[model samples]
Structures are given as C-alpha cells and as structure tokens.
Target: MSSAVISISNQKGGTGKTTLTMNLAAGLARRGRTLVVDADPQGSALQWAGLSSDEKPFPVSVIAVADNLGREVGRFAEDYQYVLIDCPPTLETEVTRAAMRIADTVLIPTLPSPVDLWASLRLANAIEEVKLRNPRLAAYILVNQLEPRSALSQGMKQALEEFDIPALNSHLRRRAIYRNAALEGLSVYCMGKRGEPAAAEIDAIIEEVL
Candidate 1:
C-alpha cells in the first residue's frame, strides 16, 4: 500500500515539532505500520527513539536522512503505511523544503504566540510555492501547548484564518506528561493513566487530520 506522508514542520524553533511527530507516529502505529524520518539535522527524533528500552521500544522505526530527503522518504514509503517526517526547525533550509514537496499533508505545528502566527505566514507562502510543483499537497496549522482558558488559545483558530493555511480543530494542551514521556523515551500512549489525556489529544489530531 502507498504510505501517507505527513511532514511535521515549522519555520521557527520551540514549536514542539519533533515531539508532535513522535506522538503522532505512536497513534498512527496503532492503525498500521508507521515510520518517522528524522530530517532535522539536530536529530531530536533519533534521541527520543534512542531513549526507549528494548522491552518497550518506541513503536515503529525512525531513520535519519542527511540529503536527498524526498528520495529517501519515497523509498521507505513503499514499506510503511504512514511516514512522518520531522523537518528541520528553519524554513530557510532545503530539508524543510524537501519535506513539504513530498508530503501529502504538511502539518505546520505552531504556538499561540503572535510571533509564531506571523512566522507561519512565511511557511504559508512556502507552501504555495511547493504547491506549484506539488499540486495535490494539503497543509494545516496545528496549535500546540494550548491553555484552554487563555485568550490566545481560545482565539487560535480565528487567528489562523488570517493565514492561507487552515488550523486543525484538535489541539494539544500544555501537559507535563508530554515532556515527562520524552524524558523516559516514550510516547504519551506508553505512560499509562498519566498519558491518557495527552494521548487523546494526539488521537484527536490524527483522527481529524487523517
């Protein structure tokens, strides 16, 4: 079967891009075989996966590709049902551009800050450019680390409407469990009750986006 390539990308750092990529892959693995492409030069996804014990390793496989990202992802796509690419933090890099070009859906993870929303405009423009070549590419904004009661969080979707790319209806709240899971090299799904809510957030996102 052909894999659904989803790129977790953003122009700015601190957007929890890699964190979302790992957890999203965990959720997707429940449905079928999943793979994560660690396209970020920082190799954060590799570190996260490395933290897992053999007894309870991170579900699915993760590989790092230094160059020819699209070609590498395409080769692996034939082997998995889902491939999530954890792109480099900056939009200026070819790694980010390559991921967008090959992605069936580009999930641009962003914060609720005004600065992040503005930065997304740059990525939005980049998406349009990629679309010129990849006409079927679809994109969305994923508002992360949300505070449900905060003014900015409540108005996130409305704020995203200003950009060409739409925001996902489901969002992830600021939960210690996400970081906690990271410390242990596990997805929220592997954390038992502590991870349930966060896992639900991931499930909601995958459900809505897919």
Candidate 2:
C-alpha cells in the first residue's frame, strides 16, 4: 500500500505544530521511509532539521515551497513511503490549502484552551473545504502541550469531544525536552535511542496514527 500523507496544521500559531511534525516524522521513519515538507514560511521545521547549518543529522529533504505548495506536494508522493507536511500557522495560506487538499489525513494540534478550541473548529471547517477537492481526506485533532493532573487539561478533553472532532487518546504533555531536542537537530525518537519519556510518547503517537 502507498504511504499516507498527513498534514500537521492549525489556524493559530505557537501550538507546537512543527515540533510534532518533525518528531512524528522521525518516529515513523524508524518503520518506513518518511519525507517532511516544510511548507511554512518560518522554516522552523527545516531549521530544526539543522539544514540551516552546513551539516544535517540525516538527509531529510525538505521542500521550501510556501506559496504554491499544492503543485509541489503531488511531486512529493512518488518519493517516499510517507510524506508529512508541516503547514504554516494560518489556514489562509495557499500552502495550507494545498497540504489539506492532498493529505490522506490531516492532524490538527491544539492546546487545551477555549480560544484554541475555537481556532481548531475553524481549521476543521477549512479542512472540509479542501476535502471537497479530494474526498479521500481524513482529519482529526491531537491535543498538544497538555498538562497531566491539571483541571484545564481535563476540561479541554471534554470540550474537544463535544466539538465532535476525533481526538487521539494519546495527548502530548508540556515538556522542555521537546525544545531541547529540536536545538540538537534531533527528535525524541533519536534522543531517546537510549530510552526516555519523549521517545515513549513519540512511539505512542506513531501507534495511534498507524
């Protein structure tokens, strides 16, 4: 079977979208071929891959197409077993629409807050609009930066359910390790090669997605 193309997106920024995309791509790469498309103008994911420097951890080829990404994405499908598009924050961008239009699945990452939930709903609507162009697109939300043992996290989970968006049972908790790993141009999947919480979380997300 061909690999699934999943776009990690959100309307509002600073929701750990790039962070999750890179880590998840690395996690899935352990099992099969994976390519990451850095469709965001910020190029954070590409930078995180250490592409800004002369050296990179591995050849994670990232296409720096921010404007006309839809056309570029079609070309990406033939190259890898999985193509994970890390979209720009705003859904208004054509790159975001392109990723949504071709994605086999769209993973929206959101914080556990009312404002974030509202933004997520808007993102879901946008994904639906793109689905009109490609009826096979499947979409869902994954709760990010969740603080375990907190009331806010509990409330947000309930609100997401009420919104009727299917959420992954595995929620990513707020942790500094994620940031630290990014700086090293390494993902938790690689950082935890010796065994760590970050690695375990990444593995869980991969299992859920698969």
lDDT of each: 0.90, 0.80
What TM-score would you give candidate 2 relative to the actual structure?
Answer: 0.91
Error of 2 at 42 (Å): 0.7
Show how many residue pairs clash in every candidate, following the order shown. 0, 0
**Residue pairs with clashing backbones, model 2:** none
Off by over 4 Å in 1: none
Off by over 4 Å in 2: 51-59, 193-195
Residue 120 displacement in candidate 2 (angstroms):
1.4
Best by lDDT: 1
Q: lDDT tens string, model 2, 66-123?
A: 6666667677666688889998888665777788887888888899887898878877
RMSD to the hidden true structure, all candidates: 1.0, 2.2
**Predicted candidate 1 versus true structure: per-residue lDDT over 1-115, tens digit per residue:** 7899999999899899999999999999999999999998899999999999999999968899989987888787778999999988887679888988998999988998777
lDDT of 1 at 96: 85
